[model samples]
Target: MGEIKNRLRKDLTAAMKQRDDFAKSTIRMALAAIQYAEVAGDQARNLSEAEEIAIITKEQRSRTESAQTYADAGRPELAEKEAAEADFLTRYLPQPLSQDELVAIVDAQMAATEAELGAKPTMRQMGAVVKAVNEKVAGRADGKTVAGLVKARINS
Candidate 1:
């Protein structure tokens, strides 16, 4: 198993020993998700770090969506639970890039592309810019959010 997976298992055991219901449940869920992927893939090997991140991101996105839906339905308690679980998952994730950091990445990408093309890139070049920026900021920012920032920068 991956190092993160092992660590999570250890943490889960500790949570169980300490009677931390939230932590125990959250970690168990993450572990189950990882195991499910491995079983589905029919691979004996563990997930790579990137694969782990992808799995966690998928879970986090679902939790966020559920929280939003619950809140909209006037279920604040359930929404809070979902949001808290999402935050717990995020503790295992790399810190998300700040707006300033994202801006810097976008600026660097735009400059590089401009220098290479000898012209300011148009909206049509948004895809290329976003692709490059994602490569630079992978695991630190969401692709869709980064793409939006890149598009706005190009248009500006």
Candidate 2:
């Protein structure tokens, strides 16, 4: 098993022993997602740390979206639960980039992209710019935020 999967299993056991319902359930759900990802292709295989992080990130995004939908439907209690689940899942993720850090990354990527393309990138090159920035950030920053920054920078 991967380091992350092992750590998650350990944490799940600890949570169960400590009678921490939220932690136990959240970890269980995450493990289930990981397991599903493991067998998701033509053949079963172990997941690398990056793949594990991607699964966890997808899970977090789903919880966040669920929370928003609940809130929009006038269900604050359900929304809070979903939001809390998202927060719990975030513990397994890398520390998120601050706005300043993200902007710095975007700036660096924009420079690289400009150099590669032999000019400042216009909106036409938004895809290339966003792809480069996303690779540099390596999941530390949110996609939408990165895309927004790329769009704004390209436009300016």
Instruction: Give per-residue CA lDDT, model 2, range 1-156, as digits (tens).
Output: 888799899999999999999999999999999999999989999999878988999999999999999999999999999999999999899898999999998999889888898999998889988988887777788899999999999888
TM-score of 1: 0.89
- lDDT agreement of model 2 with the native: 0.92
Q: Report clash pairs, candidate 2.
A: none
Superposition TM-score, candidate 2 onto the true structure: 0.93
TM-score of each: 0.89, 0.93
Model 1, 54-144: lDDT tens digits are: 7888888889999999999999999999999998999888788999999998999899999999999998888899989988886788999
Q: How does each model score on lDDT? A: 0.88, 0.92
Model 2 stretches with alpha carbons more than 4 Å out: none
Off by over 4 Å in 1: 42-44
